[model samples]
Every structure is written in C-alpha cells, then in structure tokens.
Target: MSHSHSPVSAPATNGHDLAARIAELLTQIDTVKAEYATLDKRANEVAGQLAQRFPVYDELYMSAATEYNRAQADLARTKQADTEPDIPLDDAEKASTPNQAVRSELSGSTHNAPISVNKLYRRIAQLAHPDKTDDSNKHTLFLEAKEAKKQGVLSELIRILALLTGDETRPEQLSQHQGQDALAEKLSRINVLRKELTLYRSQLMQLRNSPMARIVDLISTNTTLSITKAETLYKMTILQRVKELETNTSGIRQDIAFQSNMNKT
Candidate 1:
C-alpha cells in the first residue's frame, strides 16, 4: 500500500508560516507601544513641571472648580426635590432638618458601582499565563501582568493582552487565508495607535501653548527673564484668569436661576 506524504507535510508548513506571521505582528505592536510610552512620559513630565512651578495657583483653581461643580449639583438636586411629593415621616422625625436634605443629596451622589479588581486580574492572567508558554520572557510578562492587575491599571493589562493575542477578534477556525487576516488585524491596530499618537501630539501642543508653558518657552529662548520672575508672572496672570472664570461662572448660575424661575411661572 502506497501512502501520500503531501497531506502530512502541508499542515506542518502552514503552522510554521502562521507562527512567523504572528511573530512579525508582535514586533510591530511592541514598537508602537514603546513610542506611546515615550509620548505619555513626556506629557506627564511637562504637566508636573507646570504644577510644581505654580502649586498655589493649581490648588486654588482645583478648589474653585470643585466648589462650583458641587454647588451646581446641589441646586439641580434641590429643584428636582421641589417637584417631588413630600413623604410622611415617622413621629420621631416629624421635623424636617437641613441634615436630612444634605443626606439625600449625598446618597444620590454615592451610588457608583464598585470596580472588580479580581476580574481584571483574572483576565490579565488568562492572557499572559506562563503555563501556556515556555519562552524566557513568559515569567516576566506574568509578573508584570499581576502587578498591573493589583494596581488596577487596566490600560497596561489591555496592552499586554494585545501583544500576546495578536487580535482580540481572532476567529476560532482560522481559514487558509489566516496570514492575510492576521496582517489586516495588525494593520488595524497600528492605525489605532497612530490616531492615539496624534491625540498625544495635540495635547502636547496644547500644553506648550498654555500661559505657564509660554512663559517657560520665552525664558528658554530670550534668556533675559529669570525663572523666578517668569514663574511669578505666570502665577499672577493665572490668578487673574481664575478670578474671571469664577465671575463668569457665578453670572451663568444667576442667569440659569432666573430662567428656571421664569419657566416655573
């Protein structure tokens, strides 16, 4: 009996080709990841410098914004409560207290669902599980995945999964055109990375155009203004801007209330 050897060799050849395609895609993904990390680090460093140079301005701005938001939320909640029917209270709580209304506002604001750290941990582990691979870096990948999950860094976990799995939408039954499909998926991912890179570049440009950043740039180029003087100027300018914003916010609030009263009437 003569047995054909072509059928046995074809599957092995296809497997090798598939592995090579996956490896190439992984390399490309790694390159994109490195570039993104660099951009993100630079953006953060620039932001940190701005914050450090003007700590008081940053703090005051944050506090004012927070207070404005909270006040607006409270006003809206009060208006909503006014439209609702009053419920009868128990004999012990016959008197309506200010604290009762405050508690209701707090309750409404505190209903967010809890994050499941364990679920994220499991997902990262499943993707980079060392038991599935004998590569030297498998152990390192597993450790990093575990730490990212522990710290609730979902983005890191997602990046790791993308590197390991090539494509999240990989079909269960890879057809004869598997290599073409893999290439297409990898190119799609690269497109996403390019878009993200553009966004980061735009953010960097915005930061560079900020008042504090412009002052820093001027000092760098002109060499006439000292760092201390430049920072002082930036602080003064930013404070004035903050005051203007606060005034505008207050005016808008008044206008909203007037319009609301008119609608009610």
Candidate 2:
C-alpha cells in the first residue's frame, strides 16, 4: 500500500536542502536591504533638490529626509538580522512617577516651570508623595506611582498623582502628563515591534532546521518506507513550534494594549 505525502512535509526531508533554503532567504533579505538603501539615497537627493528650489519647502524637505532615514534604518536592521539571526529584543523599562513625567514636560517647555525638582518634590510630597501619606495603601500607591513616572509610566503616574492631589476633578489640567504618556506608549509599541521582528528571525532559523531535513536524511540513509509516516509526524511537530511563536506575538500585542490603557488613567 502507498501513502500520500503532504507538500509541507517535503521540506522536512533533508539537511542540505534545508540549509540551502535558509541561505536563499538570507540572500533575499540582503537584496531587499540593498534595494531599500538605493531608494533612500534617491529620496534624499530629491529632498535636497526640493529644498534648493524653494526655501519655504523646508518642511517638505525635512519630512522627506525623515522618511529616507527611516528607510535607511529599516534596511540596516534587516542587514543586522541577516548577520545575527538570534539577536533578542529588550523589554521597555517601566516608568517612575508623575512628578518625573511633569519634569520631562517642564524640560520640553519654552517657559520652564520654575518648580525646582527638590522644591517640587517637597511640595508634591505634602499632598500625595509617599512620605506624606499616612494610609498604608495610599502610601504604597504613591511610591509605585512615583517609580512608574520615574521609569516612564507617564500617564498612569500622572493620573495617580492627580487623583491623590485632588486634581482628578480637573482632567484638562492633566494634559502635561498626556505628552509623557504618549511617549511611553510609543516606546512600548517600539519594544513590541522589535520583539516581533526578533521572533520572525528565530522562526526563519527554525524553518531552516525543520523536520523535513531529518526525513530527507532518513531517505538518503536508505531507511525503510514505513518510516515515512513517522517523518510526517515530525513535520507536525515543527508546525506546532511555529504556532507557539504566533501565540507569543499575540500575547505581546495584548500586553502593549494593556500598558497603553493603564497610562490613560
């Protein structure tokens, strides 16, 4: 009796072919990077021409330059991934306190709030800073909130501070914290994207070493035909592993959303 083999199972049969496929993918990645770099260079040249033709087009030129740099960075990242397939992404660090977030806002302002860090610390402490809070729960929340702001949980930190300081009734007053919160959210999204990219790189490596290569080895070794069924089972195993990566990416996205919502508070 003869059994049919799946197309996906074919790749699981041999080492040489598996390695060749991986090498092909790496080549493709390199080709894409080269193409992107060429396009980016052309974009910058165009942007320069625009700037020369009309000084008022400075904003347009700047925007074009920004896009070109973004492309360049993306291509650089792809090249790095091809060179080092196993690089892992680091998680974003958590924020410190609402005061810290406000300080960041202050630093960005043309009119700096003369609120000295130490003075601000003392004044804020009088209201809701952990040292001033007598209730244990409020104190704990205050400390956590402060640390979150310091680490960069700007929105959550600010909201907590506002609630503790009797500013919860005035949501508009919390606008300063909004900018920081937005920045934190962006950083969190960046971290998730990096991790997703890393997972894809790892998946590429796994596909290169899949069970299809092992089945091929068995065939080359003149193994009995009965073991072909076993090879198909091995292909299922690799598919399951890839599924695990997909699940992980989903979880990371959920975490990013949760973090964003937490900041809005």
Q: What do the candidate models score in CA lDDT, each in turn? A: 0.48, 0.40
Candidate 2 — which residues are off by over 4 angstroms? 1-11, 59-265
Q: What clash count goes with each model?
A: 0, 22
* CA RMSD, predictions in order: 15.7, 27.3
Q: Candidates' TM-scores?
A: 0.39, 0.23
The TM-score that candidate 1 achieves is 0.39
Cα lDDT of model 1 by residue, 1-265, tens digit = 9987786576443445655655665565465545444443443343346557667766665555555555455445545455522222221122222222211221111111112334444555555566545665655766876787668664455555555666443232233356555544554444344433443444444444545454544455645556566666656665775686578568657856775786688
Evaluated at residue 75, the lDDT of candidate 1 is: 49
lDDT of 2 by residue, 59-87 (tens): 33233333333443444354444442322
Candidate 2 at 75: error in angstroms? Answer: 30
lDDT of 1: 0.48
